[model samples]
Structure formats: C-alpha cells, structure tokens
Target chain A: MAEHPSSPIPGEKPRWLDQPRNVTKVVWALVAVCALLFLSDVLYEKHPTFAVEYLFGFYAIYGFIGSVGLVLAAKWMRTILMREEDYYDRDR
Target chain B: MTAIAELAMPISPGLIVILGGLLVPFLTAGIARVYVLLLSAATLVYVLGLPSGEHAAFTFMDLDLQLLRVDKLSTIFGTIFLIALFLGNLYAWHERDRMQRTAAQIYAGSAIAAAYVGDLVSLFVFWELTAIASVFLIWAAGTDRSFRAGMRYLIIQVGSGVILLAGVLFHVHETGSITFGHIGLGSIGGTLILLAFGIKCAFPLLHNWLQDSYPEATVTGTVILSAFTTKLAVYALARSYAGTEMLIWIGATMTAFPIFYAVIENDLRRVLAYSLNNQLGFMVVGVGIGTELALNGTAAHAFSHILYKALLFMSIGAVLFRTGTCKGSELGGLYKTMPWTTGFCIVGAASISAFPLFSGFISKSMILSAAGEEGHFITWAILLFASAGVFHHSGIKVPFFAFFAHDSGRRPKEAPWNMLLAMAVTAGLCIGIGIWPEPLYAMLPFPVDYVPYTAVHVITQLQLLLFAALAFTFLMRTGLYPPELRSTNLDIDWIYRRALPAIIRGLGSGIGVVWDSLIGGGRMLVSATIDGAARNFGPYGLIGRTVRVGNGVAWVATLLLVTLLIAYSAG
Candidate 1:
C-alpha cells in the first residue's frame, strides 16, 4: 500500500516501460529468480513420488509449457469461438 | 456481566443484516453508510462470540430446524462474509443507487445465514433468499442488457434453490432427517444437492453464469457479488460433500479450463471472474481431499480468496467507474495517474497468484500438498499446472494490461478515497495473512500444523511462477501472445442464450404457420354455413316461395298424412 512516486515529467507520454535497458533489467531479474530457484533445490526437500517432478527444473518446465500451451490453445480456441462482442444480440 | 452474557447469546447475523438492510432505504446516504458498517461490525463481533455448536433451534411442522449452527466452519465463513460486507460497503460508499445498497445488505445477510443455518430446510430458505436478493444488485444497473443478464442470473440462482429444495425433501423422505450434514452421492437426493451446489460453484460447464453475470453487474455490484455467491457454494460443498472423490476431478477441470479462457478474455473484469472460478477450484479440491489439512486449506483458501478476489474486483470496478470501461484493449497506462490503485491491484494480483509472503501461498498449497500426499497424481498435476496458469494471467497479465502495457493513453484519476481505503485494508490483510496465518489457521475446522513457508514450498512455487513469467516474456517477444480482442467467446451459456432459444422459437414459428392454415379452414366452414343459411331463409328456399298461408297449411297437412301412413305400414 506504499504510495508510488509520482511520475516526474507530467504529461510526458508513457513512462520508461519499453526502454531496452528496463526490459533487460526485468529479464535479468527473472533470470536471477530462476537461478535462485534452481539453487534452492539443493537446500529444499524433495517430496515428489511422481517421476516427472523428480527431474531438475521440472516445475519450471511444467509451468513454462503449461502457460505456453494455455495461450496457444486459447488462441486456437478464439479462432473457433470468438465472435463480435454483440454476437448474442445479433438479429437473425 | 449478566447483561454482557445475555448480549453474547446466539443471534442470527444473517437475519440481522437482512432486517438492517430494510432500514437502509429510509436512512440518509451518510447514515446508511455508517449503518451498514456498524451492522457488519456488530455481526462479526456477535458471530465471534458464539459457541461452537448449534443454537437458535425451533420446530417447523413437527420437524426441528436449527437456525444458527455455530462452529469453526461457519465462524470462518461468517467472519469473512462480514469482512467482505464491511469492505464492500466502504467501496460502495459513493454509490448513489439506493437499490444496490439495500440489495447488498440482503444478499450479504442471506449468504451469512446460509453459512450458519443448521438444517437443510433452513439452508434452502437462505439459499433462495441469496439468489432473490442478489439479482436486484445486477438489475440495479438499469441497463437493458444488465436487466436481461439479471434475469438469466436470477433464473439460474433460484433454479439452484428449487433443486436444493427438491433434494432436501427427497433426502428427508429417504433418511427421515433434515440435518445439513454429509450425504454423499449414494442416493439421488444427495446427488441433486451436489448439483445444486455445483451450479453455484460454477463447476466447469455449469460455470458460464459466473463469467456471464458478474461482468454485467455495476462496478460496486460486481465487487459485492464476487464475495458471497461462489464462496457460499464452496461452503455448502465443504459442509456436505467433503472428501467426495468426484470433486477432485471436477475441481481440477475447474482450475484448468478457466485459465485458458481468461488468457484471451477482452474484459479485464471478466478475466477476474474466470480467476475467481480457478481459485474456487483449489478450495473444491481441498474439500474433495477431505483430509483435515485439506479442509483447513479449503476454508483458509476461501477466506483469502474472497478478500483478494474482492480486491481485484474492486480495482477493476474502480477502473470501470472512472474510465467507464474495463476492456483490456481499451485500457493502459493508468499507473500514470492511478498509481495507488495500480499498487493495490498488484498486491491483489500477487496474493491471488500465490507468491510467497502473499495470502494465496499459504492457502493454495494446502490442497496441492494434500493431493500429493494422498497420491492423487493426476489431480495434483492438473492443480499444479493451473496454479502456474493463475499466476500467468491474473498476476501478470491483469496489471500489465490495465496499468503497464503499451499505454493506450487514457489517464483516469485515482480511485475515490473510500475505494482506496477499502483496497488498502484488503491489501494489508492479503499481506498480513500471507505473513502470519496462525489466526486464519486457528479458525479452520480442524487443527492445522502444516507449515507453508518451508524452503521446498517457497522454492518450488517461485520456480513455477518465474518460469511462467519467463514464458510470458518469450511469447510477447515473439509476437505470439494473443492480442486482446473485443470479441465474445462461445461458451456453455450460448445454449441458453441463443441456440436453445432459437431452436424453440423456430419450432414455435413452424407450428404457428400450421395453426394459421387451420384457422383458415375454420373460416371456410363458417362461410359455407353462412351461405346455406342465407339460401334456406331467403327467396330461393321452398318455405320462402309459399306466399299463401292456406296453401302452405294444406301442403303441410297432406305431407303429415302421408308420413303417418308410411309410419303405420313400417310398424
């Protein structure tokens, strides 16, 4: 609930969201998080009786594939299911 | 001390809320605000003071009905319901619509009553009351589409109530008891009850009403709606159907399907609606697991989910309030002006996504751990995937689109102070519960010793969430992430909304055409009858040609004499 610093330049269009340097910062931070998770595996207990989860980076891979699969599937679904917003109310 | 003890005697908070709601319309807006807050706070206090057993019992037609069933389960739910009511009232403080306020009180009151009632019959009464009361909030929006949507929501809700009533009647007939306790699907009545709860829980295909109706509600209306309805269903399920094996698969499906739908949803509020379903799946799985830990998980998850989901709804609702739209495609760069809202929205996102040190991390893990320990391999796998999917859409995509995406250049002001206050309190609780869950855990139906913040849990959850984030980054970089489109996705509701109606209408019109020709045939019959009568009565008839009375009389006598002779010969 901390108040975010107000943008310095008033009326200056979108903040530095798309700047290459900022994107890299986010990517690097993500990489750091992944690396920490990989490292934490050594200290963390392995409770998996399932074969798939015993593998290194199993959650990472599972999450990655699951997310990508969801997006792809949803996109494919949209092709079949998506229609104009008023599809329900259209007069035949 | 005796007066205090008397005051602590069991009272139905649900009844209080409803009765108090009746007073809302009469009070000035300011007084009404204080009235709602006081009513909710008092109810919470009274509910907390109740002993953990049935009180407030009475007889109905020689059958006993328990109006208040005070226990750990009801306590947790009632507490959260009251908290939601308080926050919801605060969020809705600026609302000028009197009906929304009144309906909120009744809806919340009924939901609280449903949670506390001790018998199936009493539960049914409050169950239907919830549906009947809540629909007014949707209709209070006063748009034609909202009115139509409200009707649909009402039909489904009250229809659930009807099913519940039938189930209860049959259950009492078979078992000769109306206790609202576990009756698994061994009998038809129990199954009917499960279906009734399922309809409210939004079990997969039965789920379309949630995504359909919640989004159509007014800004504050959606916030209030999200808190009570599905969670009430979850409470019902946990109450009666705990450890039912079927719930695991159903919950898994509930968890998985919505994330995909949420991914491509254009309306941000609707996306939250889907996430709400996904979160309920976790609770359902917990209920299905039926272990003490799992049940605790379900209760805790529900408590946290209500808070975070309402927070999410409130944020989007605030957006809808200010900008008049919550479409992902139409919103961006709101952080430039609405930074406080953006901040609170992120907290809600993080909590829902189950990041460590957030409310979700503590509660959602209980179900997953239960499934794994119980060796429901497939259920665990699906839940795990859904967990990551939750983070992908709700955690990242929601705030990303609404506040941080390529700026659509619309800068709306920050949410009103009351809304911010509500979000702030909810946000604090989200973090607070995540950090220290003992208070929440103590309220669970059973003792909870499971630790949520172990090295293994944190690492695994982080790994899953970060990788999902990585996947999002990769997809976006590759230009493969689906652009938010202003389109409606065909779902189960299509049957009732269009397909079924169209089929009935087509059949009706076909019958109508046949009916029109049948009427035409009747017309022809009437025309022939008219012509014959005219000919017989007019100049062309035999009687009409006879002008002289004597001649007619002589002919009639001759005909009568001839007929008489014929009759005598035949005899």
Candidate 2:
C-alpha cells in the first residue's frame, strides 16, 4: 500500500483546508462547542427517567468515555483480527 | 360470461415490478432505465392506493393465504421500500448493466411483497425470491471477489429462507393457522423463525455476511442491496418476535459491538455495513420492547435508517465509482474535487450520528426512551453508549477519512448528476423526517406518543454527540486513533469461509489416508495368499510335481493298503 501523501496538489492554489492551522481551528471550535454543551446542562429542565441523567454533563462524560473505550478496544482487536490485505485472496 | 369475468385478479405491487423487471432485458439501455423508473413509480402509486387489511386472500391445502396484507406496519415498510426502489433506479440510470437492473428490480419487488404477505408460506416464497434475486447484484460486479462473496451471501440468505420454511411448517402444524402474527419464542417454530430473522438481521455472529459482501458489490448494486434484506428482517421480527425478552440483550449487543469494527475498518462501505448492523440494533430494541411507542420507534427508525444508510452507501459508492477506490487509506482531499459528494456524505454522517436535526435523532431516541420508560436500565445505558460510539465511527470517521484527511492528491470528478440527485433527495428525507417526524410517526402501528425535540432531549443528545466528537478529535490529535490500514479483519464468517473449508480439506485427506491403508492391506493379504498357494501347488510343491509319476504310484498303493486296513478295523 502506498503511504499517504502530505504534499499539496500540484498546479493548484492551496485551499483553506490545506493549511494545518485551519484544521486546528476546526478542532478548537469543536472543543468550544463541547464546553458550551457541557455547561448548558443547567439551562434545560431535566427529565430523569434513570438516575444517571441527573449527573452533571452525564451524557458528555458517557459519550466521551464510550468513544475512547471503543477506539482503544478496536485498536487492540486489530492485533488479533487484522491480517494482510490479500488474506482471503491468497488461498483462492 | 361468469367464468370469463372470474379470471381477473388484482396483482401485488411486487409481482408487477418483478414482471416489469423481467421485461427489462428486452429493452434498449436508455429506455430500460426510464421504464424501470416509471414502473416503480406506478407501483408506488399502486401500493399507496392499496387499502388497509387483507385483500388478495385465498385458500390452498385448506390453509388461508393472504398475498397482500396492508396494515399500518406493512404499509409503511412497503411505502419506504417502493420509494427506495424508485430512487435506486434513478440513481443507477447511467449504467447499461441490464442484469443488475433486472435483479435490483426483482429484489426490491420481492422485499416489498415479502413485507406485505400475511401468511408464513407466502412470506417464505417471497423471502426466497428476494434471496435468489439479490445475489446477482453482488455478482454484477463481475470479479472473482464479487462472485465468491455473492455465493457466500446467497448461501446464508437462502439458508435463512430454508430455516423460515421449516419454522412455518412447524408453526402451521402446531397452531393450524398460517397467519403471520406475533410469534414469541415459546415454541420450536417461533424460535426457529427468530433464528432465521436473526441471521438476516445480522444479530452479532450472524452479521458477517453483510460486511463480507456489500463492499464487494457493484456501485449501484451496493446502494440497492443496502435498502432491503435486513430491513425486511426487521419487519419480520417486528411482526412475529415482538416482545421476546431475549431480543433485548440481543438488540443491545447488536447496537454496541459493531462500532468497534466500524472504527478500524478500512473499506468505507464495510464500515457502513457495520453501522447498518448497529442501526438494526435500535430497531431490534424497539421490537423487543413491543410497546406501542417502541414499535412505532422501530417503524420510524427503519424508515429513516433506510434513507440515511442508502445515502451513505451512495456516497461511498460514488467515491468508488469516481476514484476507483473506497479504501480510506487511498482516499482523501476529495472535497476539493467532489464538493457536492463531500457535503452529501456529511449529511449522511450527521444523520447517522443522530445530530439534533437529522433523521436518526428523531427515530432512535424513541427506542432509547422506550428502554428508559420500561426501566430496561442496562439496555438503555448500552444504547446510550452505542449512540456516541456511532457518532465517533460513522459520523466522524467515514467523512473525515474519505474527504478531509491527509491529502492523497487524487482528484476525481464529482459524482454523476443522477447520483448527486439521489443523495440530495435521500438527505432531504433524512432532514425532513428529523424536522417533522409527525408525518412519519402517523404512519406507525400505534399512536405517536414520544416527542423528539424537547429541550432536554435536544441538549442532552447534543452533549452526547459533541463530546464523542471531541474524544475523536483528541484521539486524532494524540495519534492514538488507529490509522486506516489496508488489511482484512477476521469475523464470524472466518469460521465458515476459512476454518470450515480448512477442516473439510483436512478430513478429506485423513479419509484418503485411511482408505489407502485399507486397500494396501487388502492387496497385501491377497498377494500373500496367492504366493503361498503358488509355492505349494507349483512344480516344486508336494502334489503336482513332474517327478510324481513313480512316487505317486507307490504312494497310491500305500494309501490303498492303509485305507483297506482302516475299513477292516471299522467293520
């Protein structure tokens, strides 16, 4: 497999996305949104069907933990499950 | 006059499409596409016009059969299926592959008909028809990989049909009623039927066929394939196995596990397949709850899920169509070239992520709420976790890796106009449903009681999804997120695909060895017996020697004397 190319597309002016700073800006914006959402927990009236909903930023913490755990678990799973690209094709 | 008038019968929309599809190959390429679209549109109108309750009822072998059952549940499934058919045909308008077109039409038709059939026997007929018809779409790619994947897919699909038939037989014998109604796992028939549905629903271990095959199908073929088989199973489960307690855990497992696989998956299409499995989980949970609200959630979710899932598949298929690669490792910076597709892909991503104003948010929340309402605390918690996991993998990873990751510098043309239109329409449905789920909800099997856009609901959902996004961003920034690699991951299908075949080969060789040893031993025994006989009976032996003339005479006299003596003694 070819390694991912980092160079800008030839003969074309660099788009806004081509700059690393723009990506960082997007990430920072995402962080800000996350913070605002976490803080906005107080503004909404709560409907506590389960006890967990009463926790401050419960959804946020659960979501963050779940995602990180999933990624890490998947990364570990790759060690056992992953194989050469042509694994199935080789026997054929 | 009476006999002549009695010969007329109303046709099911499925049969209409199937017959129309059969006529596709005779038409020229350009005309066939238009004809299929028109025929599908006409069928959709016909389906819309079909009245509620059974109409095309008949009796055979003293058992009643309803070829067309139009209830609220079936109608919604049928409507969405027809819509999918029309959109699929329109999207695939550019292709001249008549076989794929025909297969797709029949497949869609069978699924629609299967949804509406009110009897188990009729359902089985359409079920197998769907299985038989849809394999060609996979095979349409015309590659060795596609061919093999198609075969595996066919075997599993048809295997499901076989199990369903067996269940139907037992069920008919036990109850003496062929009505396809709520069949809990109380009897062998019901359990068998659930297994059959589970196989198609991709319930955990039975799931690998979808991941194995859909990515192998042709571009348009994948789009068509995505809409039917699993959703049909969801319909079947909703019809029969509703309220089966076991399905709660089954559904929760279904919802939770696939996100991991989707996370590391390289093939964008396969990632969507995993996401499809996860989405089916929500529907399964709805069915398991079996309350009015929960079933409505199932129906609503199925409807919206089909559209968004198709949109995602279409986007990836378009990428595959244009760039000749769907591997995330090979695709990036495509937005610079195919901005429309990038935008459409994000819509699909956001919808699947269940953002505030997307289809999934409206539908999936109802199921979660159902779980919470019923005090299914563990399942509710699992679903909540699954929702965030979904956003991480499908919502972020798919669009990020494909369109906005590190530049691969491979600029391809934008998707065809037809494809863009199809995506645009499906995306519209996704957003429309999210905004106004009332129309969709009114079509449900029960009165709509759940509201999706409450402030608490909206803010909490946003909190869940955004934090998940933040986690993804953190992982990416930290270099902890798994890099997209060109490799195959083993799943449950590896047992059948690799392990079973290897075991069979081993057994065959073992049997060969045993047979060879037996034959060798038998041959040795026969040769040894012949050698012993030859040594005794040949010229050098005692009896048939050449010099036996004189010796034989003397021996004969001696023997005669001894015989006489013995006779005398006896007397």
Candidate 3:
C-alpha cells in the first residue's frame, strides 16, 4: 500500500488499480470480509439490549437497508428539491 | 506559571483572547499570526492552572455575575476551545486578512467565555458575541454569495441570541435567579431557552443556516467557523435542559434527517455541515438521557467531535485551497498526489464514523448505550440507523468520491505545509483519543463506567459499518448510485431565502393595488370640490362681478342682524 510520489513519467503504464481484474479482486475481497464478519456473529456471547438484537445478522441487514433507503430516498428528494445551481440568485 | 496565572486571576481567559484578537489588526500579518498562537497557548496554560471554583465575580446592577466558572464541565469545554483556537490559527497561518484573524480569535474566545460564564446574563453576552464576531469569517470570503449568506447567517445567529436574552429575562423575573443550571422544561422561560439552544444546535428544521453559511466561508474561515458556535450551544443545552424528554425525539430527528441531505449533496463542505448537525444530535440525545454517564458522554463527544470535525473541514478546506473546488463532481484521485492529506482525511473519516479504534467509537457509543439502558427502544433503533447512515455519507462517501472514485484528471499541488501540520496534529489527536480515552473520560463531568472496546460492541459496530459499505459498493457497481451534479438541493433555508420573500412580495403587490385605488378616489374628490368652487365663484359669476356691492351690504347687514339677535337673546 506504499504510495509513491506523484511525478508522472510520460506514457507510464497504468497502476494495478487501473486494471479491471484487480478492481474485481478488490470487490471480492470486500465481499469476503463482509461475509466473514457476518458469520462471526455466532461466536459472541449474547448480551441483547433489545429483542431485535437476537436476530441473526440483524446489524448487517439493518445497515444495508438503512444505507440503501437513505440513498434511494435522497434520489427521490432530488425530484422536488433539486434546482439549478443559481436558483437562489435568479430572483435577486 | 502560577505567578502569571495569579496575575491573570480576575480576567477570564476568554477576555484575554478577545483582547489579543483586538490587537491583531495593529500588528503586522506575520507578527499577528505568532501573537495569536502565543495568546491562545498562554490562555490554555492559565486555564489549566486554575482550580475548580468561580472566579472574576462582580455585581452588575444588583445581580451577581461570575465570568469564570471553573468546573469539570466548563473546564473540559474551555480546554478544547483553546486547543481548537490554537489549531485553527495554525491552519490559517498563511491568511493575511486582518478581519478573519481578528474575528476568529474573538469568536473562539467568546465561545470559551460562553462555556465558563456562571449565569444566564453573562452567557447571553458571550453568546451574542460569538455570533457577531463569527459572521466576519463568512464575509471574509468576499464573494457576493458569501456576503448574502453571511447576512442570513448573522440574522439567524443573532436571532438565537435574542431568544436566549428573552428567556433569561423571563427566567430571572419568575425565579429571581440568574444562575445557569438545570432549568428543565417546567416553565415558559425554560422552553424559550431550549428553543434558543435548539436554533444554534441546528435542531432539524432550525438547522439550514449552518449548511448555508459554512460552505460559503473562506477555506480557512470554514475551518475556524466549524469549531465553536454550534458546540457552544450544545454545551449550553447540556447545562440547562438535561433530562428534558422532548429533546430525546428532537435529538433523534436531528440525527436521522441530515444524512439524507448529505447523501446527495454535491458540495463536500456542505455535506460536512450536514454531518455536523448529525453529530450535534448525538450530544443532544446524551443531554436528554441526563445520567452522569450520559453527560460525560456528551462532554467527551463534544471534545472529540470538535477535533475530528475540524479535521474533516480542514481536509476539504485544503482541497478547496489547492484545487479551488470541493465539489464531489469535480474532485477525485487526489490520493495519487496528496497522499498525506488523503491519509489524514481517512483518519478523520474513521474518527467520525466511529470505527473500533477511532475517537467517535469511544464517545458516540456512550450515548447509544444510554438510550438502550434507558429502555428507549425506538430511539435506540433510530440512532443505530443514523450511525450506519453516518458511516455511509461522511465516512465512505466523502473520501471515496474525493480521492478514490473516478479520476478527475486534476493534478493540483498538495495542501500547504501549515495545513498539513494542522491536519497532522489534529489527526494525531483523533487516533490518540481513540486509543486512550481515559484522559478525556477523566475530564468528564462524572465518573465513567463504560467500555467502548467490548467484543460485542466492536463486532456489531463493524457489521453495521461494513455492511453499509457493501451497500455502497453494490450501488456503485449497479450504476444505481446517483452521480454528483452541479445543482442546488433545497432545505429549510428555502423558506426564508425563497418562499417567505415570495409571499411577502405577493402581499406587497396586493397592498399596492388597494393603495393606488384609494389615492385615485381621494384625488378625484379633491378635483371635484375645486371644480365646483370655480364654477360658483368665477369672475363672471354673481359674487365675482362688480354688482357684488348690494350683495356685500346684504351679507354684512344679515351678519350684524344675526349678531344683534344672538346678543339680545343672551342678554
């Protein structure tokens, strides 16, 4: 993960990140980590603050849904709230 | 040091900083910078040396005023404010604008002053001082837009102070006590005070001014601006309204709604502003929980939040400084060039997102635990959701689109060395507090009993945050993620900025029409009277002609006869 100084040579080869295969590999790595964390939930001692916490993979599900819901809801909001960058200035 | 501290006994540290700020304009730019830094450091040293008791007491018109109330709560807030003042000055070292330098010092000093003041009257004075002094930061941007935004910001800020003053007047009249303490929501005075605090805390609909003005400030100005105003309000609220039940729901709403706006916000600084509001919600909820642990959580969170939040603003400010744009649509792949800034930004992001070993984890979880322990199930659920949402926008979205997403073909120079040093020191604090929270916890208003590094806590927090990241990846890969665009997404400020003005214009024209008709009718009546008079008394008419001799004689005779008759009757 060492980062080199960003002095670019002319016509240098693209870095590992520029490769599609490496990109796919990184995505898979993230997926694997997420899966492992979700599975490791069974190893912990139960200390439920609420009944809902006892559900299997509850945090994972809630987090995914909450984030998705936020994005989707915000996208819909753009329909009503979005305006030209100069919207405030137009009247003035 | 003790001698110096004793000599400075009666003068509040805040006043020292204010006096120093006033002297900034007289000094040369380079000297001013060093002088402010030294002044802040000296204030910190003096504040640290003092004991936990009231100092600088005086009577103002028969009411006791304590300018320096040194206790665990005020001490912690004061320490952090001075630290932020030093860090902010360091970050803006290259700034030559006298107004910004002076305003920043005065603003930070007033906030520290607000925190340490022992009574509502003194708090009101410092509170309004913070507002009046800070607006110059916004105006220092010197854009037409910044000017107008600063005006709006000033109005709302000063308006909050006005409300606080009104509340203080009412509370004093009713209770005959000006002491700032747990006023609770038992009376109208307390409610008005809470409203005032709510406005500054950016409670839900009362927020927009924060978002409207912060992004419009100068790069260094925004960094300085972010540290003081709202957090001072949070401190005030914790002092006054602890245990107020309504704040629980208010806090939850404050936490939940801003993430939605932040999700699609194109301006990175504005996104940070929304995130700032969300963080305040956590502190507010802790204040509402009202246990010793909860208040400690609030103080701890405020201390940590000021650093990390400033760190975030500093990073974006650096980007805006170098590239001249902080828009998500305009920035990406900055890590290739600005490695240090990118690393520091990630640290800030991690701290704010409450990663297991970051500042936010140790602080925010205390509030969440308080909610759960209090058996507020629904609020706990909403807070957890907000936690995941915060991770999504501030933690991931901010750094991703700015540094790692699409390459923007922008190869700007790295941030200035002073900015890097400021951010580096701030980032170090974020990590340091995360690793050893004991020093921070020790300074809290109460003893701490919570452990943030529990196995269950770490696992659950990771699951929540990582899953949110997974969701982001999915959206990006599927092309479902909304693209950043150059546009304005309206918020509550729309009412004041757009709708209210439009309504006023409509009413004005309506009134104008009525006024025009009324004036026309009056004009016509006057003209009719003049015309009739001309017709009756024209030169050729009977009264105007020379034959008026007999008429005049008759008139005089009648007048005399009438007078004679009246006199006779009276006699």
Q: Which stretches of candidate 3 lie over 4 Å from their true place?
A: A1-13, B1-10, B526-571
Over B1-571, each residue of candidate 1 has an lDDT whose tens digit, in order, gives 7654443346688988999999998998888988898989988888888778877787768878887888899999999999999999999988877788999999999999999988999899999999998998888888888888899999999999999989988899999999998888899899999999999999999999999999999999999999999999999999999999999989999999999999999999999999999999999999898999899999999999999999999998989999999999888778878999999999999999999999999999998989988999999999999999999899999998898766666768899999999999999999999999999998999998899988778888888999899888878877799988899998899999888998999999999999999999999999999888777776877555546889878999999999999999999
Q: Model 2, range B25-68, lDDT digits (tens) per residue?
A: 89999899899999999998998888776767777778787777
Estimated TM-score for each candidate: 0.91, 0.96, 0.92
Per-residue CA lDDT of candidate 3, range B218-284, in tens? 9999998888999998999899988888888999999999999999899999999999999999999
lDDT tens digits, residue span A1-92, model 2: 11222446567888776767777788889899899999999897897999888999999999999989999999999999999989999955
lDDT of 2 at B31: 97
Q: Is candidate 1 or candidate 3 better by TM-score?
A: 3
**Chain A vs native chain A, TM-score per candidate:** 0.70, 0.88, 0.82
Residue B192 miss distance in model 2 (angstroms): 1.6
lDDT of 1 at B394: 96
Q: What is the lDDT, from 0 to 100, of the residue B271 in candidate 3?
A: 95
Q: Pick the candidate with the highest lDDT.
A: 3
Docking class of 2: medium
